[model samples]
Target: MADPKPALVLHLATGGEPLLFALTTEESGKLAGKLAQLVKTGAVESVTTKDDSVVAVNFAHVAAAYIDDLARKSTVFGMHA
Candidate 1:
């Protein structure tokens, strides 16, 4: 069996829950670059998730963003550890 894919995690400066998106490493890298550019220019961008959900993100509110590539332990509720 193949291993599960990693997720792209975004932490907002507004002090709420971090946003998680299902994305490949390559996709995550591209998105990270885009986010950085948006931050530099103080712009808002719309991102499409793996699930086909469109999310509008304001880079100014993003505190941190990274690809979560760690091996995750399974939980009872099927959430990532």
Candidate 2:
């Protein structure tokens, strides 16, 4: 069988339970770059997720982001360690 694909993890601190989303490799890189640009330049009107979820948050709410390339233990859900 073939191996599973990696994901891009976004960690956002929402004051309560943090908001987490898993993005694809391509999306992750693009998001990272855009976030950096927004931090340096201006704001982003809106953004979408891998699951087609739309998200709109202030640039200051972005806590952290990472690319997870490790193998997932289960195939049912695209989750990683």
* Top-scoring candidate (TM-score): 1
The models' CA-based lDDT, in order, is: 0.67, 0.54
lDDT of 1 by residue, 1-81 (tens): 446566667778877887887865656667765666676675787766667677787778778666565356753334466
Candidates' TM-scores?
A: 0.61, 0.47
Looking at model 1, which ten-residue stretch has the lowest summed lDDT? 70-79
lDDT of 1: 0.67
After superposition, candidate 1 runs with Cα above 4 Å error: 1-4, 24-26, 70-81
Error of 1 at 64 (Å): 1.2
Worst lDDT run of 10 residues, candidate 2, spans 72-81
Could you tell me how far off, in angstroms, the CA of residue 51 lies in candidate 1 after the best superposition? 1.3
How many residue pairs clash in each candidate at the backbone level? 0, 0
Residue 17's lDDT in candidate 2: 44
